[model samples]
Target: MDSNKNTAVISVIGKDRVGIIAGVATLLSQNDININDISQTILDGIFTMIMMVDLKDNVIENSDIVEKLNALGEELGVTITIQHTDLFDRMHRI
Candidate 1:
């Protein structure tokens, strides 16, 4: 997943419903971001997804991506969080 470039982990959480994936994927697609890894599932009707995306030279900054994602979240009635890969990994690693 282009180890030499910077990446980020994006997560979305909310009630399960249609277009969750499409909404998020559409934003990413429009921004020219590449999805490195993704997994999603429904737990008791709550939708959750984690995506590792490559952001190097994506025509947008980290903050810009976060802003757009947050907007999408608002429209989709979800909560979204975007974090740098290194920061996320370090913070989550035991």
Candidate 2:
């Protein structure tokens, strides 16, 4: 099996604030999800982050993460979106 087949893409976007990265990282850490790559930036006071994470060791399903992230996003006042890496690629392919 491809090692990255279990990978996922997590996206966060909202007004800049403290603890966005920390919150997401903490959740993933507690769930045994490892971050493979991450890129974040602030644009005109808006915060944007893209994280490529490995779910091979994760104990939860992708739907579970989506729910958890949605709740976290509400608390943090941001929008969180997650998709399997394969699905992401398929949707983005032109």
Candidate 3:
């Protein structure tokens, strides 16, 4: 792995439904983002997923990933977020 590669912590949350995984995975694949780790489950019809992805080879910037995910989330009736690893770690440290 390249040390310069950026990593993003991504989370998806909402009521369970079809196409969430396909939508997210397709977008990531299209952008050259690789999912390094992932966990997903549903409870009482609510869907939740957390993923760590390497964005070093991304075709777009980190901010654009956030925007695209947000838009996709809206279409899917879910909440999708992408945060850079540095910021994610700092935010969790408190």
lDDT per residue (tens digit) for residues 1-94 in model 3: 2235578888999988889989999999987889999999997888999999998756446347778899999999999988777775566665
| 1 versus 2: better lDDT goes to | 2
Highest lDDT: give the candidate number. Answer: 2
lDDT of 2: 0.86
* Full ranking by lDDT: 2, 3, 1
**What is the alpha-carbon lDDT of model 3 when measured against the actual structure?**
0.84
lDDT of 1 by residue, 22-58 (tens): 8898888888888899999989888999999888675
User: Which one is best on TM-score?
Assistant: 2
Compared with the true structure, model 1 gives a TM-score of 0.83
Candidate 2 local lDDT, 1-94, one digit each (tens)? 2235788899999998889999999998877789999999989998999999998756346347778999999999999988778876776775
What CA root-mean-square deviation does each model show from the true structure?
3.1, 2.6, 3.4
The residue-level lDDT of candidate 1 at 21 comes to 85
The C-alpha local distance difference test score for the whole of candidate 1 amounts to 0.82
TM for candidate 2 is: 0.84
Full ranking by TM-score: 2, 1, 3
